[model samples]
Target: MSMNVSEFVWKRLQEWGLHRVYGYPGDGVGGLDVALEKAQGSDGSGMEYVQVRHEEMAAFMASAHAKFAGGVGLCYATSGPGAIHLLNGLYDAKMDNQPVVAIVGQQARTALGAHYQQEVDLVSLFKDVASDYVAIGTVPSQVRHMVDRAVRIAQNKRSVTCIILPNDLQLMAYEDPPLVHGTTHTGVGFPAESKLPEQEGLQAAANVLNEGKKIAILVGAGCLHATDEVIAVADKLGAGIAKALLGKAAVPDDLPYVTGGLGLLGTKPSWDLMQDCDTLLMVGTSFPYSEFLPKPGTARGVQIDIKGDKLSLRYPTEVNLLGDSAVTLKALLPLLEQKTDTSWRNTIKSNVEDWWKVLEERAMHSAEPINPQRVFWELSPRLPENCIVTADSGSVANWYGRDLKFRRGMMGSLSGSLASLGAATPYAVAAKMAYPERVVIGTIGDGAMQMNGMNVMITISKYWKQWSNPHLIIMVLNNRDLNQVTWEERVQLGEGKTESTQSIPDFPYAKYAELIGLKGIFCNDPDKVGAAWDEALGADRPVILEFYTDPNVPPLPPHITLKDAKNFMTMIPDEPELGSVLKNSAKELLSTVLPGR
Candidate 1:
């Protein structure tokens, strides 16, 4: 069998160390599909192709794969709509700074300008999202460099890149670029280099950190691999550590000085730490909310990041150390004076203890059916050792941020900057694919579950048996309302919940799981939330754990500003679930001070 353009493309990707691809099939990619079939063979002995129900899900899975597996994620799609479907997930990768390469099928070269069937200008469509690099293959010779550059750029820049393959060109006879002036040649592989800040810059940062009596450390996804370094520096400075949502797993929640997540979906301890700190050490995190940080001139700042452009972006830093998170922290650690006065650290630990108790009270508070927080609160202690978890956007993210305790060895991520709904399911699927030995779990709101999570369950159903440990669980908060947006309208826009927009039709999520050959468990009882998780964790196959939750229970912010309070109060008169909303809010708020209740 002679090599074709499609064959060479896959071969090159394999050489570059990408062994898996998440994608959906279409006629536009018929040649590639044929080539993939030949490559995988009857024994399934080649590139792993995850056939996602939708192209969008494929891109999301690719993004998750990159995050969990620490490699360049790859996804494929057909022409027009399929190519367009990849944008949302690709944008998710771009915003979150994950490396993902998308190989999209395009209309034939002759039909491209003619606007023939399924004809779309893919290059222009992908230009913005894949701003670093996007190219279309016009001939078989161009395919080589296109693959090499796309993978290399995506990996090195930690951004999305695209290679558009026209249908006609995909089936063409493969050929190396001729040794002529007009032709180009390319090779595979991105070599690793030790990235470190200069000693002078490290010393400057240490000086700022050393001068302050109270210090706060904020870590994001960039610090995932630098957990030890982060802990060491925080201990040295006697600082309290706060995590950005994307950095939930960067440091274990068990540490007394680790104040959980920051921002709207953060902890009160974290809020208080930032408000009081005299110094801020930001490591590999471009956590967007500047308000959650120390007020300007209140704290001296030192930021360390690999990307020079991202340095001092969120806060004004006295020293912007440009280097890898682990490398920079290691160098800076030696110059830092170990704090002998443990007063600041003790205060932070006390605050963290009080915050956790408050969370427990809130989670245990009574609701119409179940408090969504309780579901996660129960799962926190029950989370399987070394399990990988993913959460979707909406009210669920609030519980995901506050209630769950991430221990070391456990991995968790979601749509961070993008904050898109319908990402949890695909992320869990990809995590399972990458580490089949470990258990994976996904927490999704009903809104997100209906939008994309339910569909990705079918993908899970198709591949569950192949995994070594069949313990993937999808937990759906069946609130029958777009709860997050409803609360946002009340708190942010000062409007009542619009039934027309907020109410989503209730679906039998657990039943749907059973219908698809997976285990299903529904729990509306608060007492049974933990038991349901146990059942799901011990299931013989993938399971859908549905919790019939109360949507009226507000996902309160860590620190509600006076304006936010006023805005929320303004919506009370017209709010449809006025009684329940007011009651839940009161109970949640009182949980903080009402000791031993």
Candidate 2:
């Protein structure tokens, strides 16, 4: 019996254990819509078609689903703008190394160059973002190859794959029997040992650690798999441990030697320790911010990463070891000496504690209406024990990165240099879908949230609500402006000039939330923030809490010196004293407290 190509594609997806596909409906993908409808009505296999407001959110949701479920996440989109909207979210998945499969519908195959309505060259469009791209021209041969390869690439490399389907291809007749199976399928397994690192590189890394004194170890997202082994190595070497933002959950934050992260929003003691150490060892992290790194003359650095190309991209390194983080660490441990450096570890530990105390004191005393410290305090206690938090780029990133007290097992993700807005909501959706048992919360700036909030709400309505797993919460800090840019402007211009560019028009987020069938709460009084948060968490459905705040509220002080602030301040003719005030305030605060490192 012959069936349409769409039916075969649906069956393949079902065989892969894909229960849900997210995207807005369109004529270009009508065949797929019909096929999915039939499958849903007849099989009752729990496979669902989720209609979202935007394709980007679909991509985001898919990525989050993959991250949480430990499998490939699937998203669908029609040709032209629909496919283009998916680029940003797909890139996020690629950078984070999540397994995502994006099935993009194209215009008729015959109209490839004629520029038909909603026409697009998806192959070229997604080439840069996805690890693999396959255009399915035929039902059995092309669809089968593309589906299998897309799944493999997504699973093996932990990268995204794009499959382009022309509208005409979907309607093509196929004679092959439906290859259906009862058992659920997991993603592709790890490749064979041929791709493993050479033993010589591992031995060389061991030699460097064996000889170095006062070494510091930095971990990144890549170390997630080998976290235990990395911890063991840190224990053996008596090295102080620090993490990049994406690597927050790589190890427990409260470990004796674990200082905080290293970056602009990073803790002061972590930077101090990294700067002063004689030898620095980077494990599975490629930290991009060069400003925070030690000068080439100050310390000898060694980096171990799965990708050799990323070794010295940011800073100069004395040694570059290429291997899987866990595998490489395990190999190096046997050749290392268990050094006794209780005194050295204690010194760094004391410095970290002092820094924490200063931050804590400031947070306790802050009575400002839009106090970031108070917000952190309120949200921290309410977070789920095994919760995952996703922070978008902007002021919210700084607060979550610096202030959030991550318990031993919590996971978090942040947009690094790309710093794209609208990441938080999609990331949260994906995180919740991935770990249905755990809570996932998205903390986004008002400006950032508005950019992608609608699509996120639609995605939640379709998938999460249907599952009755209302574990997703969105906390929007509605300060009514782009505060990060405003701060930069204040540093560059006078306060008067900045005020002109910084004002943001207010939006009625509470009303929008209600219209979307999610809980909506508006918080103007600072005290109400805590109660609003409690209500949102306890709700049986998605909730959006919009807190109206003053845009002029000062953000957490950056980790720069007074002199640097003053020099930058001189450039702006109008706000000369503004820079001085920030610098002096930070200096005064630091001077009263014991210096770390």
Candidate 3:
């Protein structure tokens, strides 16, 4: 049987080791759908087509698939609106530096310039996000090279790429490039190699670290595979480590010297570590918030990164070592002289110990109905071993960042730089698909849950039974407000929460889960949060665990500066939930000074 261009595209993706493609059905992609159907009927060439409720979710799942599975994630969408819907998620992948390739459908080639229905200039639309590469398939011969280039570039650059397939061309028989001028041939696979810095550069970085009295190390997603190397370097320097939000899983929080997350959703220990350190060694992190880092001219900096562009961009480095995280660290280890003074390490440990206690006090702090922090506080110890965690952008992320302590072997991520809402559920779905035997959990705010998270529950309902481990849990913090933004307005803009803009309608999240043939558990009582988690985790199928949480409980930053203090104080007089806000704010502040009381 002669292979159509559409069939050839799928086969080419499979050759590059992609077994799953997340997408939705539309007439713009009808030819591709027919090819997919044929492939599905065949014995071994079939790809798992995860039909998502929205194209945006498909893109997000692809991003998550790349993040969790460590490969080029594949997603497809039909013309115009469907292609447009993928932008937000693709931006998430781009900002976080994950590899993802989008296969976009276009209207018939003949009608492109006629302004026919669904005729979109996809190449123009994708050029910014997929800035590394974006190409259109005008000929059957172009399909092979397009797929090859898209997959290879996405993986090599660790960024987004797009291949636009016209519906008319997709149905034509695929043809190999001819032995003639103007023809191009491309191959599958990017070779594996380890990059290491020069010995002189490694020694310079080591000397800077050895001379410092108090050193702080920052790691991001780049250190995910370099955990042991990071630990070794930190131990050698007697340094404390801070993890970027996207690099939460780079090192387990159980380490005494690991100071949780950094920046706005960061911990007090991390803030102190940065403030007090005389030298900074940033490994594989481009943590965006410079205000949260050591002030300029205060700390001497040294940075290691695979990308030279990312090196020293956040901090002014005395030495910049360009190499892969683990490889460079391994070579640099022999040059580092072990620190004899344990005072700096001891101070960090003390601060970290006090910080955890402060979190517990805040989590246990009483609220109007349920403290949102307590919900996550209760979940920390209950997390299943080796589970993959996902959180959407909202107040939920604050707790996910601050409270949940991830152990070694666990995996997690979110929309880091983009921080888009409605991403958690789809990310969890992709994680579960990638590792069927592992548990997965997604924490989302009520606003995000209603936006598109609920629709993804339908996607889960469609596929949960196929997973070997059916322990996927979606936890909704039902606070009835655009909680994170409301707090941001208060803290950043010194403005009161505008009722029309900040408030969201209440929905029965748990009930909706039940309606879709999944387990649903609803809890309003703060005391039973743990029991609710237990019930959901032990359920026979996937579960939606909804908690009626207090919206007034502030997601406070680690160390509130005077500017933020003034802004927060300015908003208090006109705040809608004034009393609850005052009470919770007092408790949260007191937690820092009155730990273990």
Candidate 4:
């Protein structure tokens, strides 16, 4: 049986367990779209064909879906501008190590050398960002090989794979139709028999554990496969635990041993706790923030990681043990003696509680009209226990990171400094698609929400009707201005920079949400904010709660010191001695107004 090249490609996608295909249709790839439609009818597998507004959103959705579901996500785009827009999201997926595959349509094979319409060298454009790139010029020789290679690359490296298909190649017929097999799970097995740790390494780890009075455990996403084992080690060592943001849900945050995260947006207590520890154990996490790490001269460190390169990358390690975290911990457990005194653990736990209490008190007493802390307090309680919250980079993220508490089963994703707008909405869509049963929420700034919120609503209306009732709650902090930019401007200009002068367009977000088939509410009153949140969460369909907030309000970043305060004071000009007085007054106000300063 012979078939067109596009049909064979579609059949292969079906065999790879791709039920949903995300992309925008273009003239160059019209045949492939038709082939997908035909293939759906043949297989009796009603695959979803989702048409997105932008190729970037499509790629983001694919990446998020892959990350949430632990599988391959598929997306498509036309050549030139369409394919170019996908680079940002592709880079994000590559950095985060998610499995995604992008199929891009190219200009005709005949026009390869000539500069034709929508023509660019996509292979070169994606070479650095993607794990593998395959250009399918011939039917039998290239199509199957490329498809097989893409699947393998995505699965093995957990990275993006690009398949470039020319218009002419898609229309050509193959002499032999590609044989498709059902998707089968190639199980991920641990070492057949765990390798016992080297005696030298075990002895070194045992010595550190036995001698150290105060120890801290820093866990990362590398422990996703062995959460229980890592937890056991933390328990055995009686050590305080802190996680990287990527490892947010690695363990339940409510556990007494769990302190918090460490980063620019991380908690201050986590940083203080790390500093106080005499011995720091890096287990399964490669935390990127070098500034928050303990000073090499003061704290002795030990690292247990599968990747040897990450052992001493951030901090100097006295003992670098190269093995799986669970395996290494099990080996060292027997050699360790339990301590009778847990004064260090008790002290750290008390400090963490005090820090949290201070944070909560400030959020409650703050007088700012558009308080971000207040918004987080209201929304955090309304969210489901198993909610999957995705945050976009902005003031809202800073607020949420500090105030929003993750329940035992809740999961969240934040793209650490790749901090692009429009990520939250698409990420919510993908997460909802991946885990239909879990409630998916997006915490976005007004600017970020307006970027891709409508497109995600359309995606939900199109694909998610049959699987489960789509419950998407978008909490938009509508401060009407880019608060981050405003802060930077304030820092540059002495004191009274006219923030109202900034060109921030205020749109009718609630009306816009209704226009896009989502239930919408606008809450201006602070008291009504909680009611609005509750209503949105209880609703069955997609809902957007746009809360109008004070534009002059500020959300404090994680970890600011007295030196940082002095820096702010020094940055201001000494024109009116009153400016210095006002700076001091503002500092005093923040100390009293904000929590956990």
Candidate 5:
């Protein structure tokens, strides 16, 4: 049977078990649209082509799907502009080490060498981002091999891979005998086959750790499944655990020694512990901010990681253990000696306890306009046990980093590596799709919501029912300004107040959701925040819940430096309009007077 290349590609995708793919339609991908239509007509036997408004979002949705579902994510886009649009989202996967495959449609093969319209050197453009594998499938015979190679590299290596298919080749008759399909089983297998350093290396690392009095453990996303082993190591050494933002759930926050994230988004205990520790045991994290860690030569260091190249990338190390976090910790436990001194552990716990009180005072403050901290404070406990929360990078991320608490089984991220905006909606939609029975929540500021929220909400309405009992709730902190940028002006740029240029108009996003047949609620009264959650939870369809929060409320750093303090006091008073903005919403910071204990 002579099968067209497009149909052949789609058939192999089915064989590989990729059920749903995201993309936008255009002429360069006309062959794909035809195959997709045929698949849709065949009554659910082939892949579901999820239609998205923008190719950027299609890629983001795909990346998030991989993150939440634990497999290679799939997305497609057409020719130049559409191909370019996938870069940002693909980078998110690249930086986080998530496996994602992007398929780009090129102009016809005959037009490739010429400066044809909408044709780009996709191989060159995608080289850096999809460094694992980037290739062009030039002829019909290469389609299956190209697709299979991309899928394998993306999954086995946990990186991004791209394949460029010219429009002409997509329509050509596939004459090669079909390779045996559906016999492959490269399922997601992890807690990865135990990898441990040699016995001598493990002993040398233990010797360095054992020599120091004040030890601290900094863990990253690589420690996701080694909670007990990590806790055992911490308990054995009487060390405190400080998590990287990506590894927030590596171990539960309820443990006395598990100080939360490190860096700008870190907790007070985490900052203090890193500052005072004489020894640091780094595990599985590639946290880039060296300033937040113990100053290089000040502490004895030992690193345990699966990647040897990443062993001491962030800090100078005395010993490097090239192994998986779980396996290495388990192996090292017997070699570790139990600490007899409880004073250091007690001091750390006391500081953490007091920090909670400080956080509570800030969250419970009675301000003129609602405090943004209160929103997260309320949302924290209200989240269902099986919920997954995604916070965009901004002031809201600070609130999430400081205030939002993840129950043991819950999972989340704060756009840690890319630190991009407008990812909350795409992340939440993918989370809801991957885990239909769990509640998915997105907490974003007005700026991020306006950028990519509305379209993905529409995407949710399209494929929502495909999952079993899917529930998606987006909480928009609409303060009528780029709240994070406004605060950055106050401190980072040494400016007194916000300017109109950093502002956004308050759109009735709730009304927009309602108009589109989804539930919408625009809330201003702070007292009703809980009630909005109730109403949203009651609705079967997706819901948009917007809260008008105080734009003046800043995300104060956990550990303020002399430079940050100086920046706060150094105010820019030159702008004439600054005074009026203060007069109008100066009340935005009523709680600013409260002691940030």
Candidate 6:
């Protein structure tokens, strides 16, 4: 059979069961794009090109797709700048340990060393970010084998992989059979008991967990498939469970021992439990915030992770178990002994309940405008249990971390690794694409909403009705400030005033959505917040709900430091409007310090 490299690559990608790829069309990639179009139009092709306004958004969508769907996400871009745009999002996947494959169409082979237009040393440029593997196609016969290697490496390594296709190679004819190594599947999951660690490690973990009183389990995304086992372990040991942000849905928030996400986005009960625990059982998460764990020498630790090296990366470990989270937890559950005393468990439950009350009071507080926390608090109960919620970084993440209770069976995230802005829309778009039957909600701040969102919003509008029940809802909070960073600056600087530079201009983001052929609901008045959300949620197509929120609302940390208070005091004087935020925080502080109910 006579075929070009692009034809062979697309056929193998189709066989790999990747029906959709995200990217923007650009120079030097005309051959691949043509091949992609042909593949989509053919019968049983099961392939679609998701054209995005920017190549970067394409990469962001692919990264989120990998995180949410647990598959090797595919993204493509032309050579040079189109290829460069993928780095930030690819790095997001790399840093967060997700599988992603970036395919870039390169300059023609004849253009080598000629400094041709739109030429770049893509393999070298991608090495730091796409470190799992990077290769360029030269021979037409090698196309299938290269795609096979890229997919397998990405899936096995849980990292980013890149394959470059020179324009000339993409159009070459060859006679060869495909040499593929993987099929269309999410890849290695539960029921694989063979992956469990040796008995020695499991027994050691069991002993540490059994002997320790006031044990706390910190769960990460690795615990996603092991929720039942995680809950069982917690129940048996009478341990409190704190989640890393990536593991927000590891267990239901309503569970007695399951304190919500830890670190800055953590709940107060999570802080209290981790702070007081004598032993910490770490599961499936490289949580990265060692400061949030129990004090040095305060808690002995046992960590279980699929990656052996990550077992004790964030905290000291007394026992290190290597295995898949579900498989390992199932094995360890039988070895654990039930605790007789309920005092520690009861203490954690009370803190979790009390924290909710405190959060509610804070969220419900009436500001001159609207309290941003109230938006999430109100949306929490209404969030469909099956919905996927993605939140952008900044002050909005504060509300998401604190108020948005992640029920079981939800999947979503922001720029967790890159901590970059403008990912919420792309994530929601990808979630809706991957599982269009479920509802997709994205809560973003005006700062991030204006950055990469507008473009992806158009992408959502373009693709919303293509599949079933996309139910895409984008809530843009126009707080008119780079609120998260502004808050960080105040805490870090101690005495500096927030200059005008920190403030953002309030744009009618909802209005913009309406203009772009989607539903737009805008709310500035405190009284109308519910109606806007309700309307956006009820809409069949994608809807943008932009709220004019009070920027004075602060994202209070799980545990406040003296520096935080001092900075809050210093800044509250300059912006007296933020006094309400300080007062609300103090109320929680008082509640914590004051004794029994």
Residue-by-residue lDDT tens digits, candidate 3, 29-68: 8899988877665564468889999999999999999999
Candidate 1 C-alpha error for residue 389, in Å? 0.7
Candidate 1 lDDT by residue in tens digits, 1-597? 579999988888988999899999888898899898877757876788989999999999999999999999999999999999999999999999999999999888888789699898888999999999999999888889999999999998999999999988999999998999998888777968558978888888888999999999999999999999999999999999999999999999999999999999999999999999999999989899999999999999999888888998989998998889998898888899999999999999999998999999999999979999999999999988999999999989999999999999999999999999899999999999999999999999999999988889998999999999999999999999999999999999888899999999999999999999999999999999888999999999999999999998889998888999999989988898899999999998888768348
Each prediction's RMSD over C-alphas, in Å, is 1.0, 4.5, 1.1, 4.7, 3.8, 3.5
| Per-residue lDDT over 1-597 for candidate 2, one digit per residue giving the tens place of the 0 to 100 score | 567888877777777777777777677787887888877756556566767788888887787676556678889888889889888888878877778899988888888789688887788888888845555564444576577678777876778898888888888875443556632233323355433467777677777787777778889888766778878998888888888888877887667678777886677777877787877889888788777777776767778887766888777887787777887788778888888767767778887777666665555442335455556667876777888888888878777876677776788886554567888887787677566777788888888876777667766766775443676788888877786777665553434335555566688787788897887888877777788889888988778888776554445443666654664456456652355445544543554364431
lDDT of each: 0.92, 0.73, 0.92, 0.73, 0.82, 0.82
Estimate, for each residue in 89-122, the C-alpha lDDT of model 5 and write its tens digit.
Answer: 9999888888899988999988988999998999
Q: List pairs with backbone clashes in candidate 2.
A: 64-430, 68-434, 69-434, 494-574, 494-575
Q: Taking the tens digit of each residue's C-alpha lDDT, what string does model 6 give over 196-248?
A: 89998889899988899899999988998899999999999999999888888
- How does candidate 1 fare on TM-score? 0.99
Cα error, residue 386 of model 5, in Å, equals 1.8
* Backbone clash count, each prediction separately: 0, 5, 0, 0, 0, 0
Task: Identify the superior model by TM-score, candidate 1 or candidate 6.
Answer: 1
Question: What is the TM-score of each predicted model, taking all chains together?
Answer: 0.99, 0.88, 0.98, 0.87, 0.92, 0.94
Runs in model 4 with CA error above 4 Å?
41-47, 131-139, 175-210, 304-311, 318-337, 488-503, 570-597
How close to the true structure is residue 362 of candidate 2, measured as C-alpha lDDT? Answer: 51
User: Clashing pairs in model 6?
Assistant: none
lDDT of 4: 0.73
